[model samples]
Target: MNRSLSIIMPALNMEHLVGEAIATTTRALQRAGLSDYEIIVLVNTSRDGSHDRTDEVVLDLAKKDSHIRPIINHHFKPFGLTYWQGVDLAQKENVMFIPSDDETIEDSMVGIFKDIGQVDLVVPYTVNKKARSFKRRFVSRAFVILCNTLFGLRLRYYNGTCVVPTKLIRKVPMRSGSFAYMVQVLVLLIKSGARYVEVPMGIKPTSATASFKIKSVIEAIHALARLFWDIHIKGVRIKIPF
Candidate 1:
C-alpha cells in the first residue's frame, strides 16, 4: 500500500516524552482519516540510556502497529543528519519533521495533513511565542528576520515544523549537520520556486530540563553563513516543478 505521509521524528534523549509524541501524532493522523501514513522515529546516540528505552518502546509500538518504524543510529550525529537519514528512508511523497518532545501541534496536525497536496510545502508558525524563553524568542525572531532580509522572502518563521514534498527535499543539496539544517532546507526550497502555505499552530513551553546551549547557537550561526554563501553568493538552487 502506498503511504500518503511520512513523519520523521528525530530524538536524542527524549525517553520521557517520545512515547507521548508518537501517540499524539499517530492519533492525529488516524483521526484525520489518514490510515496511509508512517511514523519514522530516528533515535540518535544518547548517554542517558534514553536511546535504549526508546528502542524498546518503538519496537513494542511497531509490533502493535506496523506504521511505526524506528531506526537506531549507532553513532551520535546532529539533529540534521538524523533528519536527513529519515528523509532518505521515507516511502511517502509528503514528509514532516516533528521533534520528539513536541505535543502542542497535535490539534493542527489533521488540518495540515489535509493540505498536503495543495502546495509544495506547508510551513507552520507557532501561535504562542510567550511559551518560549526570552532568549529563544529573541534569537528566533532575529534569525527569521535575517533569513527574510537575505533571501527576499517574507516568512513568519523558519524553524517551526514544516511539511514538504519528498521529491523537492531530495533534490536540494543539503549540507548542514546542525539544527540549522531545517532553515537551510526551507530556504533552498523557496529558491527552487516551491510554492508554500503557512498556517498558525500552537506551541508548548520549552521543557525546564531541556538543554539550550550557547554552543548550538554558534553552530547555527556558522551554518547560516555557509547557507547564505551557497544560496546568495554561489547561486545554488535546485530546479523543481513549482
Candidate 2:
C-alpha cells in the first residue's frame, strides 16, 4: 500500500514515556483527517528494560492499527545511527521524525504539513519549556546560525521534529562517521540544494536527555568543527553572526 505519512520515532531508554508519545501521535494524525498512516519506531539498544516493554506496546498497537510497525535495532545505541536507520526505512511520501522522549507537535503542526505542497523539508521551530537555562538556548541558536552560514541550510530549528519528503531526502548523500552522523546529513543535503520550509512548535528536553554541561560543550565543539569542514570543502567564507 502507498502510505501518505510515516512517523519515525528513534527510541532507546524511553520505556516510561514511549507509550504516551506513540499514543499522542496516533491521535494527532487521526485528528488531522489521516487515519491511514504508518508509525515506525526504532528501538535501539538500551541498558534499561525499555526495549522489552516498548516492544510489547509497539506490537500491540501494530495488531490493532496495522499502520504501526516496530523496528528493532539491537546493534546500535540511541544516536544518529538509529536515527538514520529509521529514516532509511520510512516508506511514505511525508516523513516526520519525533524523538522518543522529547518534544512533539501542536494542532497547528497538523495544519502545517497538510498545507505543505511541494517542500523538501519542513522544520518545526522549538520553544524550550523544560530547561529554562539560557545556556541550552545559546548553544542551539549558535549551531543553527553556523549550519545556515556554512551549509546554506535555511532551517530555523534543525533539532526539532521535522517533516520531510522521502523522495527529496533520497537524493541527498547521507554518510557520516557513527559519531558525527547528523552533521554529515546536514552538510550534504544543504550543499546539494534541498528546498526546506519552517514552522513553529513547542519543545522541552526530557529528563533523560544529555543536557549536562560537559556534553553541551562537547556538542558545540563538534558542531563548530563540522561547520568549518564544510566551509573548507566548498572554499567559501561563512558569515557567522557571532
Candidate 3:
C-alpha cells in the first residue's frame, strides 16, 4: 500500500502561526518516516492585515521546501470550502487537512501519519478533553450525539482532522461549506461502506472557540439540515468499492 499523503493546512487570519504550523506538520511527517508527501498550505482571505503576510510566509517556505505547496485565496470563504478546495488540489493517495491555528500537537499528527497505509480512513479523537473549556466540551458532545442519533451510527468524534483516501473523498459530494462539512462527508462515506479506524490524539489548549460564533453556528445548522435532506429525502450517497 502507498503511504504517500497530501497534508492540507488551512489558515484564516493566522499569519502569526501558519509558518510554525507548516514547520510542525513537516516535522511530524518526517518523524513518522513519511517523506513521500505534500503540504498544501491554504491562506484564505482574512479581515485583518494577515492575509498577504500569511501568503508571503507560505511562499517563502515553499521556496526552501519542495513539499510545501501554497494556495492563496483572494476572496473569503468558509473553512469547509477552503478545505474542500485544497482536497481537490491534492495529488497524493491520501489526504487530510490540519488547521493552521496551531491547535494540533506535533505528536498527535505523527500518530495519524504513522497509520497512513493501515486503514482507509484514520479518524482521530481528542484524548485530552480537559484542554477545551466546559462550554466547548458541552457543545462538542452535543454535536457528536446529534450526528450519531440522526445518522444512526456511532462515532466518537467527527470534526477532528481525519486521514482519508483522496479518491474516496473525491467521490463524495461536498454539500456544506461550513464546519459541518466534515460531518456530512463522514456520514456519506461511512454509509457507502468505507473502512475506518479510530485513534487517540492530543489537542493543544486554546482560548479561542470560533465555532460558537453566530455566523458559524448558523452555518452549522444549515449544513446539518441540508445534509439530512440530501441523505434522507434526496437519497444522496457515495457508491461503494470505489
Candidate 4:
C-alpha cells in the first residue's frame, strides 16, 4: 500500500534538537519509501532563555524542505492541545506525533512507517527500557498497569508514538489536555475495536525527562482522572465511523 503520513512534531524549548528531529524524520520517511508525507513542526511557546529559537529552527528547516511545515504558537499549550492543533491541520492518510527532543531514533521511525497500512493503528513499545532511568521506568510501568486495570485491556505501552488513521483519531473526542492524551487516545481507539498491531522499537537515551517532572505528573494525573470520570462515570464511548 502506498502510505502518506502527516508527522506532527511538537517542539517546546527544543531549539538544539528540533532540527535533528526533522532531519531524522525526513530521512526515515524517505527510507521507508514514503514519497508522500509532510512534517508539521508545531513550536509551542518557550520559557527558556533562548529567544524563540525553537520556532526559528523549524522555520529555517522548513525553508530547506517543502515537506516541513512550521507552526509557531505564541502562547504555551499543553502536550495534548499542541498535538491536536497539528492534527486539525493535518492532511494525510495517517498521522502521528514525533517529539522535537530527538529521543526517538531514525530507524525506530522507519519501523513505524513499515507497518503503516497493516492496521488502523501501529502501536510501538520501547524494546530498550534501559535507556530510561529506574524512576521513569517504574512510573511508566505503574501508569500502564493503572490504565489496563481501569480500561480492562492488556497493552505493553500507552505513551509511545502510535500511528493512526487521520479520520479515526480526529473522530475520537479528545478528553485529556496533558501528557496522558496519548493514553486516552489509545484506550478509546482500542475499546472502539480499531485494528492495531504492537511493534517493539528502540529509543535513544536522552537526559530530558520532562514528563516525569512533578508538575507534569500532577497534570497528567488530573487529566487521567477526568478521562476516568467521562468513561466510567458519564459512560462516554467513541463512535468511530468507518
Q: What is the TM-score of each candidate against the true structure?
A: 0.91, 0.76, 0.93, 0.92
In lDDT terms, how accurate is model 3? 0.86
Candidate 1 residue runs with Cα over 4 Å from true position? 1-3, 47-52, 209-214
Model 3: per-residue Cα lDDT over 121-240, one tens digit each:
899999999999999899999999999988888899999989988888888775577779889889888877888899998988987874578888898888888888888889888775
Per-residue lDDT tens digits for candidate 2, residues 84-127, read 66677887776777766635654645755564444555666775
Considering only N, C-alpha and C atoms within 3 Å, which residue pairs clash in candidate 4?
none
Candidate that beats the other on lDDT, 3 or 4, i.e. the better one? 3
- Least accurate 10 contiguous residues by lDDT in model 3: 45-54
**All candidates in order of lDDT, best leading:** 3, 4, 1, 2
Model 3: lDDT of residue 22? 85
Model 1, poorest ten-residue lDDT window?
Answer: 46-55
Candidate 3: regions farther than 4 A off? 47-52
Stretches off by above 4 angstroms in model 4 are 47-52, 211-215
By the TM-score metric, which is better: model 3 or model 4?
A: 3
- lDDT at 34, model 4: 91
